[model samples]
Target chain A: MTVIRAALLGFGTVGQGVYEAIKTHQKRLQERLGKKVEIAGVLIRDLRKQRSLPKHILVTDNIEDILAIDDLDIIFEAIVGNEPCYTYLNQAIEKGCHIITANKAMFAQFGTKLLEKAKQHRVQVGFEATTAGGVPIIRTIEQLLQVNKIEKVEAILNGTSNFILSEMRKNKLSFPDALQLAQERGYAEADPTNDIEGIDAFYKLMILSELIYGGQPEWRTVEKQGIRTLTSEKVQLAEQKQKRYKQIASLTKKDGKVLASVKPILVNKAHPLYHVEDVDNAIKLETSLIGTFTLQGPGAGKLPTASAMVEDFIYVLEKDKSIKQQGEVVYS
Target chain B: MTVIRAALLGFGTVGQGVYEAIKTHQKRLQERLGKKVEIAGVLIRDLRKQRSLPKHILVTDNIEDILAIDDLDIIFEAIVGNEPCYTYLNQAIEKGCHIITANKAMFAQFGTKLLEKAKQHRVQVGFEATTAGGVPIIRTIEQLLQVNKIEKVEAILNGTSNFILSEMRKNKLSFPDALQLAQERGYAEADPTNDIEGIDAFYKLMILSELIYGGQPEWRTVEKQGIRTLTSEKVQLAEQKQKRYKQIASLTKKDGKVLASVKPILVNKAHPLYHVEDVDNAIKLETSLIGTFTLQGPGAGKLPTASAMVEDFIYVLEKDKSIKQQGEVVYS
Candidate 1:
């Protein structure tokens, strides 16, 4: 592997983070992977948008500019939503380019479709950033599944909702005031329905369920509630009972069906999820043989999310190396 | 790709667990790896030892009996100590066999040598079972190093010592009484000095340091104090202060040098390591980008330790596939 080229699909916070990480850690990346990682193009909405990058690095307003690159190996999608990004990812998969996506909105809805397309084209997909920002929860679960059956998965999947709940609990703020604080803290967007209404956690839980069971993110099956329904009084009541309110996304088997729910749950001091405060996310995976495995870390941030994508990039490269090793003889 | 053969180096608890898991999950192994797994032999200490294995699987007291077989691809070493077993592992590595061990005594001391030997022989050395049983702590750290620089690692790496401490804290028992109860509960062995004296945790922390900073486990540099120095009064004092006593193995960089230590520390409810109770291990790695990442799970058990070996076996087999894939073109 001499030089592997990649395209950035969106110049959002995570995209800027990816650019910065690649720029700063270029030497370490090359040293670890034994290959040069070249960012061939950055796709954004506006050509007039200013970004401080090297003159050699290309910034394009059109995805076709990146698609025209003859030897492109990866397309790292950081765009939000499902329409254009989904279409772009589908096209990238059809063209046999591996994908590293940060956008869970599109992935949560069209994950099965994208996975099928990738399988058909024999390409790899990396979605570690879609759930928890930098934590290796998904990859860890994949490894655990090789030996143990994961009986239950409980997680704090949305940073915004958790931040809101924590603010409401600590500051004794009303729901509206907590939302304002979250927005002020830059943890919540102006149109924060996706997080406050539990849709974001729902999507993450759906992706988790998809990985565990298969063909999931069935919106109809998931019981959905969010921090919007919780009040300061309710938080105070839970606190009085030696409890804390955390917006939890849980997946458990009930009556032979994998049931998923995104809601605010009261947890006591004994629970691992009890102390996971503010924007930090935690996941507890209960296994048959290994008992309970819990992981807690920074869930969503620019560097953290980009770092997750980098991990995915390395994972895809690793898989590619393995596949190409076989390709040297058997495939050829 | 037809049939890969493995030899179990001990018929103890973990070895038997490995044998049972391999036997039961044969179908899964075949489907996952696209190959058949065959246990060639089990090397035991006694020829008169009775076992329930099939007649086709040979039980031998001599290492040469199993090593003589040319097709042995893997040697899962579940033996206790270094002496003869370490020599046998070295010989096996020299013979171009992959080594998976549950013994940490020699590994902590001779790991660098073994790693260099494995590299020289182009074979892998899998030691997942040596530390933290089945918790994928090592694998997680390996992934974290991909994107972030680890700053500090705080862990409860020993199960037997943790069990004893928890028993003392919960049952209000003395250290000796707790040890007796732990042994009665089968958590500690007859000669539990390795665990009680902090040597076991020291070995685990050393391995972790070696992975991150390199050139480690210089035994003299580590500050070792085990549960032997802990008193029931100290436990009571911690309880009075709403804290718990935990035997923590920590590795951190001070003035650009990695410092390692194993000692009893007091932790409050806010800390992740505080509540990690009986027979459970936890590792909290503080990093530059991802903040604090923690993993907790059942640390030691027959099935759990065996599951770790199984994980190592699969890891070695996966790497072997890649190596064989390349070998098909170059080596042939």
Candidate 2:
């Protein structure tokens, strides 16, 4: 039996979710993994924030304190953007510790470097939560790599955008009103630029493209078209035509060049992704082996994203066990 | 680099496709797996039958000839039904050889026994080809098992039944005419009692149930209904209500009791599986962690099913590598 000492970086929505998952499913995870998972510390912005966690759990604001702890086996990070999370993960990887992150922007921009560094140190960098949360899309892609050639990736990746579009259709509301409702419900961020302008989905698409194709998806080459121009008038017109409008994020590799775009598309009954509603995310992979596979699930929430992290935790544990036994060279 | 020596148990459609995949994608697979794969020999029922294969590959009618080859690491069995195939695979497991199979009925009936025997011998047994063709459904379940308790499964499993049902709807054909079309198109067998009567889907569901619930799904307890009773009139009646007839195989755990069934169901455009037409298969998984996930793909064909088996081959190879390194005990 082994005891895994872990830390939570950026105690926000995703961080709290991870801590709660660890607490709720501790027995089951331990039974399945034959190990005890101990949350060594939590890093948050405010020391006075009274989070509802175990009374004895360590809550710290110092990055130096976490770096000084030599016994840390893994780091679960869900910070908003790239900066400090990337830096913290880099340190953890250099220390030969595993890291799981839900930060899509960090992976999209700097995944190659992080993966290379992790491979060099023989530690896993898991980002299942970075894509369609808790849907197992990343691991499915990993298995598909064993015996398939992927052709196209068409997905509904942004839940906030989808929720707004769904509200516009359901309540006959304007795009602005829908966006306001989404923000009120905490689905959309305060700025709402990333969600409404398709930047969030674009980051997720780049990350997925990096995994599918072994290269970076430069943002400049992608076509960004958000749902800002869409209105209830168009939704009514689409309904008259027996179709619905969906915020679609798609990447197709044609003649060795990737055509990446995020836009709202009209879908009819014939389309498999037509039924994906509200905050659900759906990804359709067209491959040479499987023909076409579509996975639809709840995009992301506190527990779902954290569940994805725990999924990564189990994945890294199993991988580390294998690598330690064989002393085999790691591959990203 | 590692070299995998494998043998074919039946040189039929799936077997021929496996050989063709090995031939067509040899370089690509070698690059991906970092290994060399060689088809050492093939087992056939009749030596008199003419087969179009490369000159140096061995073909023998006797199963004993394969067992005599001591260096064989894995067996790829595609023989129909549960007879000599079961016996041959059992022997291979006893010899500590890994096995990959696409035989659904055999697995549905005797998977637990074979998996138990494999565990006793410290060998891997893979059956990704047993259900959902090349969609990677089984592997996805393996990953989801890390963090979720699966609650329910609803799937469209039988491609031939779906094809016939779709043909009836599209062409206004009678059931007999649709079945004839399916048989002519090679979607259904000459004696397609299994496909039309829903036994094929029943077997697939049993296999999936075993994977999800970790227990044997006794066939007698299952509620089976077929597309045999439905007529074109009923199809048209359902069509008027914007609903399509689908051959759905489902298993739900209600109040801790497992309810299993396969039958024709009416699905409207809002249902995720509504657009899964032709030979496509879709499985919707409801779990405690991820909410709902639906996967749609080409159910099975020669190359697709062969791709699934090759996927299993790769899976078992990686698993065997890990086990050999750790010297760990195997489990079903």
lDDT of 1 by residue, B263-288 (tens): 99889977889878888999998987
lDDT of 1 at A245: 86
- Top-lDDT candidate index: 1
Question: On residues A1-332, what C-alpha lDDT tens digit does candidate 2 reach at each position?
Answer: 37888988988888988988888889989998888999988888898988776765677788778766658889998887788778888988988778998999888988889999999998998899999887778888887867788898889999999998888887889998998999899999889989888888998899888888876556797888889999799998897898988889998787787789999899996786777888889998888866777888878998889999999999888988887766543321
Measure candidate 1: CA RMSD. Answer: 2.0
Give the TM-score (0 to 1) of chain B in model 1.
0.96
For all candidates, state DockQ relative to the true structure.
0.70, 0.61
Write model 2 residue lDDT over B135-253, tens digit each, in one string.
77888887787788888888999999999888888788899999999999999988999998889999989898888887655679887889988899999888889899999999977
